[model samples]
Target: MMRSLLDHLLIVPIVLPLVVGGAMLLLGERRTRLKAGINVAATAALLATAVALLRRVNAGGVEVAVYLPANWPPPFGIALAADRLSAAMLVLTSIMALCSLVFAIARWHRAGVHFHPLFQFQLMGLNGAFLTADLFNLFVFFEVLLAASYGLLLHGSGPDRVKAGLHYIVVNLVGSSLFLIGVSMIYGVSGSLNMADVALRIAQMRDGEHLLLQAGAAILGVAFLLKAGAWPLNFWLPPAYAAASPPAAALFSVMTKMGIYVILRLSLLLFGDDAGASAGFGSHWLLLIGLITLSFGALGMLAAQNLPRLVGFSAIVSSGTLLAAAGFRSPAVTAGALFYLVNSTLALGAFYLLLELIERSRSYGADLLALTREAFGLDRLQVDDDDDADTGDAGVAIPAAMAFLGLAFVACALLLTGLPPMSGFVAKFVLLSSVLNPGGLTPDVGSGVPASAWVMTGLVIGSGLTGLIALARMGVRTFWAPSGRAVPRLRVIEVLPITALLALCVALTFQAGPAMRYFEAAAAALHAPHDYIRGVMAARQVGATAGVLP
Candidate 1:
């Protein structure tokens, strides 16, 4: 019974937020302290749940939490499931959400409805998206999160904010609509919306049905790619993320992840290796696109003069790198990508919170670098002993916090650039190793592995070149340049989140063994969809048989 209880630990993270958000609505904006308290407690609870689940998953196998909505049969009802990968993502997202929430608490103003509630709802959506086993439920959760995100994105409601939010909104809506249409078509074809069931059906389909499956897969991939901020389809993300409030921007950083998560999940659970080749969509295409997008993002980062825009472009680069890892079609690469994804989210969340601190130090100026310089007093390249040591070191006073945040950000930069001592480095290393290994893409002879290997090397080198150049420029301008202002002190609230997120990055590095193991499990599961399909169909068949006459 206790084991069974642990199985459903996945739902706790999502449900806690929804409950908190709903309760906070009654408290309204008047009870600001109450709102803050609720949000902090709720987010912390969710984070704790995630941590618990992560430990359980690492120790055991996949931790599944099956919550059948309306208490219906498995086939007839929706189920919320959490595997190792999903649970790991839950931890990452919760950390991001918690940081953003803390930042919002300090920055919360008289903005109509309480900011905390919206934040909670958004968390609900994100957690739900990660945990859902039913495809339609995933869509519902995606929309739930997307709608909440629009509110958060447009929180300030300025002209630029409105414009940017609208673009994000319109693009996402189209993507969501496509998602719905695709899910419907999938159900029509497979007669089941459960992911495992659909996988089973797709495997047994005739050539004609296979074509339909291919089309559906393509459509699904397109929608998710757009959300993941893949090239040609990612035009809206940078502008919108840049335009949103700092906390909102931090939240959106993880939002691009939702799409990537779906693409990965679908690839692993539905398409498998066979689909990648048979559907005429080789994994190489993902690798090529990831390379192009990585290059594109690096260039954009280098070119952008504005701080927010630069961060936005950095997001694009991060997404591209992760996608490239996914495209490699190697479990080692996928695990590496997962490691990078979690690290990036944590590091970027800290960066966003730091950006907020920088903004506040300047009385909320839109000019990021100028504000950065003003806040840190870094107008010139050199620093003097008279200059406040805290400001020069990015406004963090706690020596450990400053060091950790800096180290984490630097690690993130290196990982994004494919550098060493970091998982990003290890990820690229594993990927390149796999690609270049004498064996090919096939497990036996390792045929075609050389081509993919070269692709990895080229991407790693290219993204690194562009990323390093851009990062060096940004670092000089933002952190090293001297300004005319003195370093201002940071509030505990502001300081806590950055410290927490940075610590998470360090923890990820140290605890990488468990993370790597989970990623391997997820990757292996993705490569072989047989277990997932078997589990869900068996559940469905058992339900149907239970209802039938003997």
Candidate 2:
């Protein structure tokens, strides 16, 4: 019974936030303090649950939580499964939620709105998306977040925000519709939406039947890619995310990661083996696509002048790195991808927060304008009747805020470049080690270790070059350039949240061993889905046998 209690921790992370969010909403938007207290407590509890579950799974393997709707069997019922990977994602979502909520506290109070309720709902969707076992349930969770996100993105009636919101809404709605179409086709073919059941059925299908399955998988991939902002379909991401309010933008970073998580899960579980062997639709294609995405994103970053826009483009590049490893499909790559996900999500979250401050202080779009009309040292402009009324009212100055901005910018650059003493570097190193030296891992038949090694080597080198260029362009202009521009002052609430996030990033880098262990266990579990299905089905069989004998 106690074990069953532990199992349900998987779903609690999602449910807790929804419950609190609903309550906060009912409080008529007046109990801001109470809402804050409830949301924070819930997030803290969720973080604890996620950490405990990850540790428990790392010590053992994937943890299964079967929530039978009305005590029914699977295939016709719903279940929520949590292994090391899901739990780690839950932890990441919780931390990001907590930090964003803290950062928005002042904004909410000043804006006189119930920010906590919407934020909590967003967390609910993210957590549920991570743990859901049913495809339909995943869609439901996605809607929960997307709907809340639309409101959050357009929270202020700012023109840029409204424009960005419309684009975000239209794109996501289309993506959601496509996702449903793919889900419907999958159900028509497989008769079961449970991930484990689907995998089992796919493994048993004959060759011709697999073509249908492959088509369904392709459609699903397109839907997720739309969300992941993969090469061709990601045009709306930069403008939408860049224009959102800062805390909202921070949460948006996690949104793209969810798309990556789904793609990785589906690709590995359904296509990793047979697709690589039988069909030629394997890691090779995905690797090539990832390369393209990485290059395109780097170009976007290089071309961007605004700080917020640059961060958005950098997210695309980070996603590319993650998918490149996904294309490799090695356990080492899986672990590396997971670590990179954490590192990038945390770093980007902090960067967005910092960008808000910089924009507010430095007048939003102050770029290096060409020094017009260079005059002699003693030349002074004499005011004429037709001269513009421009005067020396420079701007607001906040030295402490500028210092924090510099710190956050540097941290983001380090993360983007995969620099040492950061989790990004560790993630890349782990991925490279796995590909270059598969050690005892038995490669699939006809899969060349040399080919995989070179593929990974190319991705690593590409990431390095792209990072160097991006960092040199954006990082210098934002932080290190000797400009006497007045950046915005740091709000106490905003500063607290960013400080917490940066501290967490630092902690992750220092505790790479434990983090890697969780990631490895998660990767191992994902690489071997039989353990997952067996854990659930074996227990079901035993229950059936006991009922029959009795």
Candidate 3:
């Protein structure tokens, strides 16, 4: 009985939010505090469950724990599987959800009705996407999360937001259509929606079936690439993310990652080396596109005048980095990519929240002043002097508040730029080192590192430098330039979340050894997916033996 109960915990991350979200919807918008209480409790429970699942996966080694709904066998009934990768993703999602939800309580939650429920539903979708073992369920979860995001994107209505949200909605709807078409093609060819079963069938497909499968996979890859914000498909990302509310933007940071996660899962599981002829099928395209995306992101960051938009482009950079690394199909490279994923997501999310606060701190007069000077053809230097001239005795210097915000901003800059003494630096270092020399002491002198690896290394270094310069310019303008703006009043709710996220990045830096080890293990498990297949099939067997599944 205990074993059965433990096994059921896999579904809690999905089901709990669904229940809580539905209940909150019934509670109406007036019961704000009550709804908040429920959300907090639910999110806390999710974090705890995610951690427990992570522990179980780690302790149990490479075996994936399968949860079959209604005790029905796969290729028939729904299946949720928890392995090291899924568990880690779940934990990351929970952490982001909790922090974003808590931060929302400061003000954003009340800006619109059903915010709490929408938030919960979004969590439900994210958790579901991470855990589901079938392609169909992945689609269902994708729509769920996208629906929630549609609502959240327009939470605080402004012309900018509404327009951006409309574009976002249109793009995703198209992606959804492609997603469905691709899934249908695969289902028609393979007659199975189960990922493992699909893999099995694909491996044995006839030459004629190969063309259809490849076409379907290509369409599916396009949808995932769109979501992952790869170069040409990602033009909508920056504007939409920039216009979103702070908390929403923070959550949006992880949304792109979901696309990358799915791509990694499918690429490794379906078309890996085990799949004859299809091995490394899209590897070159992924690498080329990834590099292009990286270049685009760097240029976007350099051209960005607003902080929010810059953060949006940072997401692009992170996505490009992950895609390029995954394309390598090396365990060490994948591990470093995963580590970088976590670090970059947290830092970028925190920076989004911080950007809002910083913008809020600036006086509206500053904008007006700039416009007036520009219209009159006044010198920018003269405006700067005028602004600084009045700052002699604005108020008692709250050096501590200024210092805290400044320091936090700097930390975010360092992390985003992959500079030293932070997790970003460490993650990039690991990835470059791994790519350059896969074998540490004894290098593979025969083949040497691939030319692609060298290109990626240069791109990584160039992008980081670009990001550093961009961030430094923004920092100087925001913090050092005499804006004559008062320091933003910091709320504990808002400040705590940002501080916590940056602290986590710092912690990750310090604990890089263990974290890298875990990521490396997860990557190894993904590459050799036989364990995942056997574990899921084994669960079906156990259910059959107990006569609990038909």
Candidate 4:
């Protein structure tokens, strides 16, 4: 019974929210408490299940656990496969979704009548996207999440949200159109939408088919780049993320990761070293775009005055960093990038959640007033030392709420800037180390790392410096310069989520060894994905009656 249950766990994350979300629609807005209870309960359950799935995938016994909801084999039926990569993504999604939902319970849930249901459907879409083994369902889940996000983006229905949401919708709509075209072209070229099968065929395809497959893939990549907020097509991201409510903004950080996730997934699965005539396809573009966007994000962070906009640019930087790592196509570098991906996502999500609580101190156009004071040279002196802190002169007592906000803000700054003793620092160190080594812990002097690796290494360090300058200045102005600001009215429920999110980042630092090992194994599987193909292609229905055989 235990074995059977564990075998089918892949469907739980996708189905639980879907069922609960549909049920939420039957409950009217008057039953807000009931809706909240159901949503929270469902999210918590999903998170627990996702954790179990991750553990199962990490056991080393399961190279790939494939689950078929329908009684059919792969390339013919919908398959959900949980390997280390997808499993980790599932856990991360659940963590963000649960935290975002709990945070919303305090206030944001009341912004719209359909907020609860939309939120659950959004999780459904996210979990589905991470687990699906085929392009068709991948596209379906993409639409599901995008559709829900349209509603969630405008949930509060303010002037800024409405304006930003409109652009968000238009850009995503174009992306969707491109997505469909790409899918159609890929299917036409390979005659298979199943990712594993498509890859298997790609490895054996004739020379004449190579150009068509590459073209389709390039088109598909554009859609993903648009969604991931790569440069030139990235203007919509900061505004949309900035305009969303705090919880929505927090979840939006992972939403951007989904695009990067698919890019990494397909780039490796279908176009890895195994894809003859198409190996390493589009890698140069990923590297180039990642560098450009990382630079853009740094500049944007320097320019952003609003807290949310700064976090939004940080999300872009995370996206760029992951894409550049993927471009390396090295298992060692990819492994480190995976760890960094988790750390950055958690940090950015926590930062967005913290932004709401921090803003309470800036009520009633206080930020504007501060700007005006600075414009007229009336702003307080920039405090350089703890003793010279602008908020007080030793006799002043800081309220507990203000203290918590200040500390959390400091933690966020440390994480974003990759400062020492935080997971961000560990993540960057490991990632850059792998880039320098590429093959192992030791480097070969005769054949050193690539020139691009050196460039990326410098940019990684430079981005951290830029982040420190931007975040530190903002932190000082927010905590120290605003000397007479109000103590934000924070609820235990509200503060608990941010604390928990940040605590997880701390845990990652202490447990960095195990985390890096798991990611190294995952990256190894990705580079040589024979197990992924075998699992998908050889999947059989549980207790089925069919001619399918391995």
Q: For residues 1-550, write the lDDT of model 4, one tens digit per residue.
A: 1237777788998889899999999999989899999998999999899889889888778878888887577788888898999989989998998899889888788877699999989998999999999898999999999999999998877677789999999999999988998989999999999999899899888887988999999988999999888988899998898778889988988899999889999999999888999999999999999988888888888898878788888888888888899898899989999999999999999998898677667745643233223323232232245534545545666678889999999899889878889999999999999989987878888896689999899888888888888898888878888654656567898988899999999999999998998998999999898889988887766664433333
In order, candidate lDDTs are 0.71, 0.73, 0.85, 0.86
Candidate 2 positional error at 262, Å: 0.9
Error of 2 at 456 (Å): 4.9
TM-score order of candidates, top first: 4, 3, 2, 1
Better of 1 and 4 by lDDT: 4
Report the CA-based lDDT of candidate 1 relative to the real structure.
0.71
Give the TM-score of each candidate: 0.86, 0.86, 0.93, 0.94
Candidate 4, residue 124: the lDDT equals 89
Off by over 4 Å in 3: 1-3, 365-398, 541-543, 546-550
lDDT of 2 by residue, 1-550 (tens): 1236765666677778888888888886667778788878888898898887767666654465444433446656676777677778888887887788788775543343667777888888988888877889999999999988988887655567778789989988998888888888878877789877777777567776677777777777787888888888889988988877778889889989999999888877766464433333446767777777877787887678777777888888888777777887778778877888998899889888777565554422342111001111112222243223333486434356667777777777777778777666876777677766564345555555677568557766675666668667766666667444544545688888888887887888889898887778788878776666655443342134311111
**Candidate 4 global CA lDDT score:** 0.86
TM for candidate 2 is: 0.86
Off by over 4 Å in 4: 1-3, 366-394, 544-550
Q: How well is each residue in 1-550 modelled by candidate 3, as lDDT tens digits?
A: 1246777899999999999999999997789999999999999999999999999999855458888876776667788999989999999888888889889888778877899999999999999999998999999999999999999999867677789999999999999999999999989988999898787777788877877887888899999899999989999999999878888889988889999999999989988877876677788888899999998999999999878788899999999999999888888889889999999999988998787666655545443223222323332222344455655757435445567778988999999889999999999999898888776535687876789989999999999999999999988987888545565556799889999999899999999999998898899999888888767655653435632311
Candidate 3 differs from the real structure by a C-alpha RMSD in angstroms, to one decimal, of 4.9
- Among all windows of 10 consecutive residues in model 4, the one with the lowest summed lDDT is 371-380
lDDT of 3: 0.85
| Model 2 residue pairs with clashes | 361-487, 361-488
